[model samples]
Target: MTDPVSEFSRPNVAAGPNPFSLSALPDNVAFVALFFQRDHYCTNCRSQVQDLADRIEEFHERDTEVVSIVPESVDHVEEWQSRYDLPYPLLADPDASVGDAYDQPVRFGILGALSDFFGRMPAVVIVDRRGDEPVIAATHRGRSTFDRPDINELIAELDELRSA
Candidate 1:
């Protein structure tokens, strides 16, 4: 099977030298917190990313990279980047291929597949890169639009990973 982390690559709209890929993170980066958004207009998604941005230093301190992926075109993600001025990588997954590869939740079957707004829920995947290849160390697949982990919960997960 193809490693999704290696396969996933996208243009970084926020604070990128260029494209961001899980397989090519900086050597110092031990983990990657991949945030999958429901859509471009979800206020909860926006707020979550902003919250991550605000506490980015915590991630950095643990040698983790915080990445937020939106299943929207580059233009939309660019607007978000411009508006939020996020400190970490803000990626645009126009086709949501990466989200699909990571098994991000999609409800309502056909309708959810047709419209991210209606079906897609939030998800967070933590990739541990300490091994020879990146591995999915943890995941939080939201059952509801609001069912997602808080910043502190994420930090705790990272701490647990580091200790392990």
Candidate 2:
């Protein structure tokens, strides 16, 4: 298995340069909010992306970049970009390599490993870039389909991190 990705460069299907990476963030960007999606058809995942998109300005105000990682092909993710026109970066992690790197939860053991829809849950990884190298500042690993954090909660976490 490939090692967990501490930093990644992937095709960006949303409003930004192509193939966004941790190294390519603007100098003003202090944090990166990586929202890992469960699958292409997850309603909760869709809602979360939309919610973030609507509040992207808040992240920008905090010098953060909101990136949504979808474990699907670029073509499939493009459909989402077309529908929502997200203001942030929407990346396609088709092979789930990035998800596995972040240890995204998988349930039912072998069965969950076999199918993402059945096993893979959502995750939010906050990467702090204030130091010499980017580091994981916080993580919210969902235990169930509905167990993800709220938009305000994410903003609050970023606010706290910035203050500290």
> 74-103, model 2: which lDDT tens digit per residue?
999999999999999999999899999998
Clashing pairs in 2: 4-101
Candidate 1 lDDT tens digits, 1-164: 21435367799988754688876677889988999999899999989989988899999999999999999999999989999999999999999999999999999999988999999999999988888778888899999999999899899989999998
- Once fitted onto the true fold, the runs of candidate 2 whose alpha carbons sit more than 4 angstroms away are 1-5
Model 1 has an lDDT value of 0.89
TM-score of each: 0.95, 0.95
What RMSD, rounded to one decimal, does every model reach?
A: 2.1, 2.9
- Model 2 CA lDDT for position 105: 89
Give per-residue lDDT, candidate 1, residue 93. Answer: 95
Error of 1 at 131 (Å): 0.9
